[model samples]
Target: MKKIIEGKIWTAVCVALTLLMIVSAIWIGMRYYVSMDIYQTPSMFLEGEYSVDGGEWKSIEKDRYITDHFHKIVFKGKMSKKLLMYFGSLTISSKNVWYTLKTSDGTVIQSYNFDDEKLSYEHTQTDKPLALDMPNTPGYCVKTIYPDYLTKTENITEDSDLIFEVEYPYSYALVSYNDCVDVTAYYNEGMYLRFFYDALPPVLLFVLICFFGLFFFPVASFILGKIDYKYLTFGMLSFLWGLYMIMQQISGYLNLWIVDPTVCMMMDKITGYCFVAAVLFYFKANMSSRGTRIAANIASAAYLSCVFTVFILHLCHIRDLNASSMTMNFATAGSIVIMIVLLCVEMRINRNALFFLLSWVPLLLTVAIDAVDQFIHLPGSHYFNYGLAITMIVQIVRLIGDLRLQYKEAIRHQQMQKELYEAKVSVMTSQIRPHFMYNALTSIAMMCEIDPKIAKEATITFAKYLRGNMDSLKQTGPVPFTQELEHLKKYLYIEKLRFDDLLNIEYDIQATDFVLPLLSVQPLVENAVKHGVGMKEDGGTVRISTRETETAYEVVIEDDGVGFDINEQKDDGRSHVGMENTKKRLHDMCGGEVKIESVVGKGTTVIVILPKEGQPNEDTLS
Candidate 1:
């Protein structure tokens, strides 16, 4: 027991320390390579090549300086009509502002103006060519952070000097290309598949891995027997959370028309709220306390009501999509507190809850911290996904362990029922033959006239033998070796009176610390005398020996008489029933086995092997 406890502690420490090292390493490396790998090239724009508002042209390395305003960048460029002249891979949407391009001679080539309400695309407000089929809503440009991201390519007819301008209400706009390089040439120029590496966001990757990892628990549970409710609840919760993460990183959908952006945002809100409800229900599923679970259900219903109200209001244009997140985050914080209290209440009343609580407490605390972070507003708070992903991994591993242990316990319970039934059947199988009973009664009746004292002794012995055999029906588990030996002596005494000088009995008991199933070994002795020695006119000796080795206890029952072939098939009515019953009883009640060796016209040897170190349990002993 101590060894098992120590092993668990060591395993937990090793896993915790290992995860700490991995997360630390990844966080440090990601800090260096997150946005730099895609844009840090020799072809990047130089400081003196462009100017804003006719001032000195200074290079902008960071993405936060250009927020909520208009800036016109005038740069000198000598471009041949044969090469493509364009600037694309911008991460901003076109709703807040638009961009236009014109040459030094004031001839406008292309312009997109979704930001201005006064001008329409069909109305030639500016002397410029319009991009084809621009959406009324701002079309989101492709995310240049991903390798497969697509962008708009604008061609200039004859532009030696280009004036580039951005009018947006945001601080950051990722500029992937500022020169005349096409997507095909850019993909081949750099390190092989460098854009692919840039596409791999660490948090999104973890979320995807968790989506598959959380599903393994229910699969394992299903194989064990029935799937658990907690597994279903937690699995769905994890899937929805992963979906929320994926939707957050998706860049351009307005241009793609796969689904409306409004619908996508609505789905995000719906899934997020559903995940919150599922988490509360997950705890409620495992809860043993009726009052606590009921309270949790009410809390869950109330939270869901709030979420649904917000969702409906947002869909009806009563509230925008981003506005509901604050309300939901606050509600999530309230739900977390409610659960914390309920968990404590449950832990105090139910000891079985310790297993769930020990690992779950930290995860809940992390969730609470995350919920608060949404309102508190911390720098680099975008990386909260790291903590969430790690917690989910730990929770899944712990849940699997708990479910497997529960499965084993259920199997053990079923085995006990079977062992008890086998014990009862074994007692019935070891019943003394009716012929022996009639012969013993006849001898006792005859002895009463010849010797009254001998007759009384024989009657008492016969009564003891009958009582012992019947008493065995009530004993479903193992008995003491001493008690079993007394029953054996009573049966032998009755048999000896019938076979006066023909039958011989011997006993050798070398071990007595362990226990065996009631009537287990006695049946083997009965089988030996009835089928082996009793078959001969001059009955042979029956020997019963008990001994022990370092790891197991042994009982050998031997008879010197005409023995039947062990390989032969057993008939319907036979003496082999006792031996077969004993074998099954020994195996089912304890971790033991029986081996029978015999030869035709020779002798039979039956050995019962029981483990020495095995302590009898409820089913193994009374």
Candidate 2:
């Protein structure tokens, strides 16, 4: 049992280490993706020439103006320049907007924007237009500009004269003039990538810790079952909950690299629902009854409904790539309500479920903060993700501590059982000595009077058998079959002197390479001679034989005497003391089975089947 427990611990540790390596690999892969050099630059230029107050057309000239604080051009006046170049912010009240920009040589540039403000216009002279149209020209041309990657200047020499126009104001004025342009790209800063990379080590450590926590739970369950300790089920449940949470954290980190926000949101919700279901299932299996089962089924149905609803919304385009806050809020509210209902059911069933249920406290806070953070565009929500990792680790530790206590209790119980068995064996062995000594002494005295020479031989055999019995009492394992047979021979020889001509014995032993419990065969032979042969008026034969069965070593002792009914005789406790002792010794030593078959006035056969040495029985023996 101790070896089994140790093996379990070893396996758990190895699995924990393996999971840690896998998590580390994933973390490294995520870090590598984040660190790759990538950038998205959105550039804009004038699409049409227009002034804020409908001013006259002015010549558009390339001018480089440097500010005192920063070396950058503020503005170059042009009546043909697009309205987007006149202001820093553009707010369109119209349902749609369209504009055109004309260049000096009558080239035109076209641009458009939806309600997405992040893709708003930005002004920069370095970002040249491909084509533009002069306010009154009918031809278009590309603007010349010095390329960043090339040393030469590219000019708008081809197709310089073209006319361009666009209809706008579907709902209201869709186009507006903007002067200042924000020239920023929507890409993560290098420092933010570094932060993500640095998070790998801690995340990997936490995953390893959770795996270790889960690994011990099954072993703890087995030990607890052995000792009948039911409360350890809580420890198992806690570890399972910890594992679910760790899985969620790992999945969340993975989702960051996935560009589809809808899929990411769905994954998050599914993970949360899965965690709740796992906890509820554990509670229902360990603590609650039919009512909890019904409640769990209802919660499960609700979660599935919510998942289906989210999918339908996405499919119908009601929830697009950028879903509105109201849609997300509704989903979150529905999920929380379902989870809260499940929590209430759990509380009604088991108050101790609170420990596991309370783990969601921080998770609930995270969800609320996540909602506000996404709306207000704030940071620190990632810290809540980290907080979840910490809570999972704490729960894992608590589970481990609980399992350790159960293991200790199991070990204690095993020790008590072993002690009780030893005590019973000792008492039974003590009962055999006095009666056996008296019978042997009486036989030797009678032999001495009748035959002096045979008496001396009988006394020597008696001495040897006694010595074997003494050694058997001290040892706790099977004796060699050869040694047991030799003891039986000595006992039969001593008994022969008592029976004289009335007793006839025969040995039909088969070749064997096995062992049995000490004195196992001798006691049965002694019982046959005393009870079976002694009751017959005519001389009877006692036969001892050893043979091999398909599965085990078989020893048979039979006597032809006034055979009693085996069933009626076995229940006579006082008469069957030797039979009981033989049974107990076989059980403790070789884990063999003893069977006695008899018929009144026919004969009695006692067969002992012992497993081959060094091999276990087909079934659990003890």
Candidate 3:
């Protein structure tokens, strides 16, 4: 019945976590998709360039044009035209002298030198005339020449199309131009792609899940410390993957170094290696022999060396940016080899390796997709990264479940141990009870036959001792110092009837602010009577006292009688169950210390020092 309830609770927890992961993934996907859609589309622009004659149209290459002294010029012509005059105008400043035609309208067009600062016209008689540009010269000169030609390209008729050659003197002579529509369009596309590829919605949700999941670690640790197979398995993998993502994000943000790309790629591969290492560690800690654990550690160290080597190569530029892709390849091969070794070991031991083996699938897929993307620049490559993250989360959840189960088993075991210990103490206490009762009854029977009044008194004392025992057993709260003393007095009175004039009892309790363990005082008093006074031939005195110490409340029971040898075993064949039971009860109840000072001729003194309220002094009891 208990198992069923526990199973139901665990099942519910798993279901809830699964639902949360799904909802978070969806939320992240949608937000990323929406943001991506909004930023991907680019705006279009329509601009025209004209030559003196009808020629092929040229569109400006905005990026190059803005930074160089070249402006695009274009026109078209037919084969019938013999010569065409191409007229264009531009301003020449003292800082800017020459102009160059950066791009021609047709692929076959070539350039020839023209006067440095002059605006010129090209004469072409051919049918097809190409477009050309004078670099770094302003359009203000053309406006001045034909003010009304704002929206038109003026064509000077000739036999053929015309072309002009241009050159520039300085590199920085090109003027910068901004087109709002074009810039806006570029930004939209770039931002949309970034948002889409990152999958912001799912990532945000996952972050929250990770944050909340951390709280369960302590609870899981306590309950499943022994059965750490699943906890270590999932915990190690999740930690590796999380670290990998963090490294990727860091590289993405700090991409100024030459080795950044390599580092980023290595980080991804290391994540997989780390996952494998985590699995190996989990198995080692769980079921692997010492030799297997050592081997796993050695293998993990070797893989780490390989990772460091890749990093060094990248930093030193021994391998180009393209060569960074090989890191993943090496890692993948290494992982496969390690996996085989682990599987073989597992097979030999007849242990289940399914979980560890299955964990590698998503990681392998992630590695493959990433490698392909880096080498060939394929589409949908980033989705593999997302897949890896999701896989890691699933693995974490599974690990958490395993941890929970282990925790439950541990708790159950502890409870069972506690019950067994309690039962043992109870049986030991029962042994002491019968012997003490038999002595008290025999004493009372003798008193009844000799003296009626003394017999009545002895009988009452016996009844009071039994009553105190029953009350102490039933009461859960700590007994006050004064009340516990009263119970001790009753028990000692019964013992007095058995020993008659041979026994004398003394008690001096000073500290009464707090309570002590229930029935604790009586047991120690009974021990003093049985062990200290019982061995005396003529007579004995039992002294009981309490005092407040600097750190604890001290209770002392000392008796000077026919002191038995402390080193030798007791002559009475019976067990020392009473003393043992008293020690156990004090340890459990108040966690107080029990000190025994005994000698062959001196006698015995049992000193019990209990801690005051608010202090859990387990050391004293231990």
Candidate 4:
């Protein structure tokens, strides 16, 4: 269970599942807001007459089913004066007046001219075409309620010639004058809700995700990651696309002053192409395959050429949007499908990146649904710009996923650095221990000349001391508690030879099976004898004890000797490197801890705590 829990494959799966849960939660929350109320349409519609010309009310084209691109139809019949009329495109008055309501004899009853931050206009001759106030935002946004709905009193005669023009080739084009205006309002609300969520919040969310506080995080990430990121490109794309969608949703009132739907479609096409191009750039920026790069570059150039060509034709007053739209949809859809396939292939080869590619699944679905909707024309299916907003969200998720991988990589790098440090410290302590070994050997050599029997016994003990130190160096993993204790005992026996009766040792060994880093306890014992005991004329006792507790195993090395002040800004010029190295290795290798306490001229105690279980998961480095 422990192995499975900590395994790499399971860790990745856990992360993916966690992210999916969070995304699902958020999606449910958004669905709640997008469906604040169930808006239902009334069961009836208003009916009115259409005429091709003022003289022929029953002419062949009098039914005036004009729709789609540049359409001019005349509605010159009477209806309920207690009526509500709205245009989804820019409108004109034959009298060179801004929108006006006249009685039967042509006496204007009410007139309105719009020009403000949200709307503006230019009345030339008898044409009333208006532009929006937002910069680089080419469109019309005029929404005016002729008279408050509350002002409706009695029925009277009404007549007007309404012309309609839009960008997207209409799937259904029919002049609709619903006699039941109340039903139209409720019907539109239901339709709009069904199509999409509120555009304002989604747009704002994408903006924040892209910039993350004035582009601080995105800019820093770009520099640190060294990739030609497309966050800004996608952000602009969503911004324009969102505006275009919002205009369509509030068309009757919001954009009645704007010149036709041409502006809306133009904006959509331009940004859509730009968005597709940015995707190509993102692929090139992060890709390694030269062939893929060449292909994406060619595709991007082709898309740019087509978009620019269509834009030039539109600018020159040649307004046909169908051909360009068809081309754009096919090209964009094909490119996205190819990209998705490539990501899937990459994921198969590198399962470590499975979660990373999973982040693009939402974007791929959006592309596929839009492709089928545009090309197949399924009557039973109608998709809105919700996918457009969701695509931006997926990109944000991708960014977050990339950052997560980077964070993990950073943590791995840090672990490697720590291991290297531990090796370096081990080598340092090994060097210092050899100096102590030489001193002990020297003492034995002198004893050999004076007392040959003592020297022989000392030589046998020296072999054990040397063997213990070499064993510690050979095995990087911790040894059993008893094994380490034996090494310490061998070390103390060698030191006792030089100090004879001056060195006294005591043991209160209780722990039996807990594992600890090699040589972790020996150095503390060596320090007690060398620094604490050797400082006094009357040598002291070095007491070593170990106890097993519920959580951890505690080991204490105490010495009754002339101890130095721990906080005194003074040293014995020895550096005390071995004691420090032992403390660090114990804690880092085994989830252990070390603490030291001392009183001047009294005694010193060094306590070590080792976790009483399986080896420490080294990732939890202290």
> Which TM-score value belongs to model 4?
0.42
Residue-by-residue lDDT tens digits, candidate 4, 494-545: 7888888999999998866677877778778877998799888999899999
| lDDT pick, better of 1 and 2 | 1
Query: Pairing residues by index, what is the TM-score of model 1?
Result: 0.47
- Candidate 1 lDDT over 1-622, as tens digits, reads 3344335445644654565567556656766765643423332221225555467755544232222112344445533222232322222223233454444566544454454443333333443232322233223331122122211223333433555454332233322122111121132233223333433354445465444436544554565567777887777767766665565444223223322334444554576677678777877776878899998888888898888788777656666444556677778878867876787789888875666666565556665575565455444433455655666667777775776587667667567757666655656544556777788898888889989999899999889878887787677667777788888887888777777787899988897777888777777887788788999878889999999898888989999888888777868475454555567777777778998898777778999899865545445544
Tens-digit lDDT string for candidate 3 (1-622): 4465456557656865786778677766666555542332211111233331134445443233222113232323321111111212211111112223222343222222234322322222332222123223211111012211211443323332333322222242222121101111223224334433543444444454444343344334533434344453454445555555554443332212212122333444556556556645554544455666677677667766765776566456464222443554566477567755766676667455556556557856776776555445443335566767666666666666665566567667566546435534563365246777787788878878899899898788777766665555456545667787877787778777778798998767686665666666666666667667787777789998888878788889898865666677767786666567667656656677798888766688889878775343445433
Identify the leading candidate in terms of lDDT: 1
lDDT of 2 at 608: 91
Off by over 4 Å in 4: 1-78, 84-265, 283-288, 316-323, 337-384, 389-395, 418-622
How does model 4 fare in lDDT? 0.54
Instruction: Give the residue spans of candidate 2 off by over 4 A.
Output: 3-7, 10-216, 219-289, 308-351, 357-360, 365-379, 423-622
Structural similarity to truth (TM-score) of each candidate: 0.47, 0.38, 0.41, 0.42
Task: List residue ranges in candidate 3 displaced over 4 A.
Answer: 1-37, 41-198, 209-219, 225-230, 243-287, 316-328, 358-401, 437-622
Clashes of each: 0, 28, 30, 7
Give the 10-residue window scoring lowest on summed lDDT in candidate 3.
Answer: 138-147
Q: List model 2 lDDT by residue over 1-622, tens digit each.
A: 8778867767776877787788778777776675344322122222223222234443322231111111111222222222222222222111112333334554433233232231221323333232221121111111111122111122322223323223232221112211112121123342223335554455456555544444456555664565322334444444545545544434333322433323444444445545544544443443355665676556556655665665566556554312332444465466556556665767776776677667657756776675555345453335455556556555566566766776787777677556435643553464346776687789888878889898898888788866765665465556567777887787777667667888999989894567666666776776788778888898689999889877788999999877887556255445555557568667656678898888888878999988765444435342
Q: What value does the lDDT take at residue 483 in candidate 4?
A: 83
Query: All candidates: CA RMSD in angstroms?
Result: 15.0, 18.0, 19.0, 16.5
The lDDT per prediction is: 0.60, 0.52, 0.51, 0.54
Overall local distance difference test of candidate 2? 0.52
Off by over 4 Å in 1: 1-60, 63-215, 251-259, 351-379, 407-418, 431-622
